[model samples]
Target: MSEQATTTPTDDEQRGASTLELFFDLVFVFTITQFTHAFGHEPTWKSAGTIALLFAVIWWMYSGYVWLTNEVAPSTPARRTVLVVGMFGFFTLALAVPDAVHGHGVVFGWAFLGVTLVHAVLFRVSGGDDASAAILRILPTNLAAAICMVIGGYAHGSATYLWWVGALLVIGVSPLLSTARGFVLRTKHFCERHALVLIIAIGESIIGVGTGLAEETMNLQFFVQVLLGLTVIYVMWWSFFGNDNEHGEAALDDLPMTDRTRTALIAYGYCFVPMLLGIVFAAAGLGMAIGQGERQASWAAATALSGGVALYLAGQALFRAALGLPRPWMRLLAAILAVLTTALGVYVAEWVQLAAIAVVVYGAIIVDDVIGLRAGERSSYLAG
Candidate 1:
């Protein structure tokens, strides 16, 4: 590739995410909405497994684009066109999600293949030599995964599941098969891009509250549920955006290129799967709990609520560990407590269970702050 075709910004020229990138992320928010709505409508183990499978495949490529834009921004008209095409692919894929495991598998597979192709072509044409070489090394496996998706689309019956699982394995193992030493990590943009996606996904929880409220009569109970739901969402946001982003950025910036690349794959690429899944399940669960103050929560709804929060806290713990940050003992304890609330949901009123989860999460944050204060360390929760 010609040097001029490469869009990798120099270290001195590093920047945050661009407007086009933010717009691109808006397309992904639609996918998040689809997943949340689907799960909310049918909060079953089967549905949850299907959503997980789809998310694993979709998130892998979405994260790949984040890496792509970090190194090769769409500053040029040509690059912008390619990215917009990729956005269309994501939009189409979102449309297919509600029925992906059933009737829309073909459409989902084709949309995914298109997205994968766009990522490869854009990176090869616009990335720096090292990045170009890196994408080239992994291109065959990527294509193989995409082709598996296509074959999975054409599949039917129980056989379809096998094909899709095979596709996930192919892509999931791609990082192990290929090396990341050739790619660059633009730390600021990389961190900001991930933070933006996460915050947008978090918004789905608010949307869930709104969705539940839409069917209920406005009353004292309505106001109470709204407050409790917002509290849970707000606490979740604080848990991540508070200081984890800064810690993550600092950790990556401190590493050598090869180590940084591997950490990014593990931290951002792998750990984020559970974090995002937690948001989806939490949103679905919260939607089910809202306006049902006196009724006992169904098993699926209860598990979705408590288990979802536990998953998020656990994912956060893992994210911190991956970056070599101190262990999040308080959050880990909170995750355990969150899981224990499943019984509370099944027996007590849904509102009570919701309240317990909120207390556990917010209380953990407060305790974490107290521990930091006692140790004479700057509190991570208080720091910007």
Candidate 2:
């Protein structure tokens, strides 16, 4: 093992997230709240699209910093300074979220740029020490991205906005892209913990639905909406905390130290793509069920819930493939689609849409549980 790797906390040393990391995560709660509120106003396909893209932007920005703290261990003095400055920059970005694409985009740009520069300087300063080689690997691309981000902010009025911003983000993440194979110090444990954090974040979708329902009405319809929201949460718990997590960790355990960390990073890092998509769709689905488009509620909301489930399962598939696990995510995907189909039938028959979605979700859980039981039985039989 490298001296650096040995000196760093082992998986046993850091049991999940640190207290400070959790505090940093609270910042994102603001970001998510802003996202839901902003999207809530539009509540259309376009809004959904915007929210999805925004998730990529936000998650990439956030995870990169987390990765740095891991490789560099910035909780110390000089590193602490970088983190504090970055925090100020992040705060600005959070404050600008209410109008990122429109009114207050400049604030967003300035904040992101500040963070970018802060990150770059930290890399430059730490060069050749404390994984500085890894740091340099990302610095140039990130700097280019930061410059373009600011320029894109200035050009939001034209056709150039899409191309500029898209290109910028591409450059920003190119190093972290699959090619260089990511940082050496990258740990799967770090990534998995973050992945769980995201699942917990997605659980917030249920809250969004509940908050929406609590606004101004009460009836069988209202109660059904609440029940459906809860059901979606149940499904997330069932699907994610199922065998995939255990198998994923076991797969990591099977690898060499560096290999384990790298695999974990790739598997966990990429999960943000599908997870954020799923979570956002879930939120949108909830939005559909409460007060807007009463006629379309059944189909639209069901679609959102189903889409979210699909994304989550798909992410798991990719993650499992990376981890060399069997195709466990497939069953989850099948269950999701099955429920969605049943939901459609319920809608056409004019039953309460939310109630229908709830039943479908519970059915999926039951199916997975049965599969688990059968698998256990087979194992026991083999043992005997």
Compared with the true structure, all predictions reach lDDT values of 0.85, 0.60
Best-fitting candidate, measured by lDDT? Answer: 1
- Tens digit of lDDT per residue, candidate 1, span 286-350? 99988886899999999998888888888888898889866576778888988988888899888
Model 2's TM-score against the true structure: 0.80
Identify the candidate with maximal TM-score: 1
Q: What TM-score, over all chains together, does every model reach?
A: 0.96, 0.80
* Model 2: residues with Cα > 4 Å off, grouped in runs: 1-15, 122-130, 158-160, 168-173, 176-182, 186-189, 290-295, 298-302, 328-332, 335-351, 376-384
Per-residue alpha-carbon lDDT of model 2 for 138-198, expressed as tens digits?
6766666666667666765654357445744675457456334334343444655575567
Count of clashing pairs, candidate 2:
0
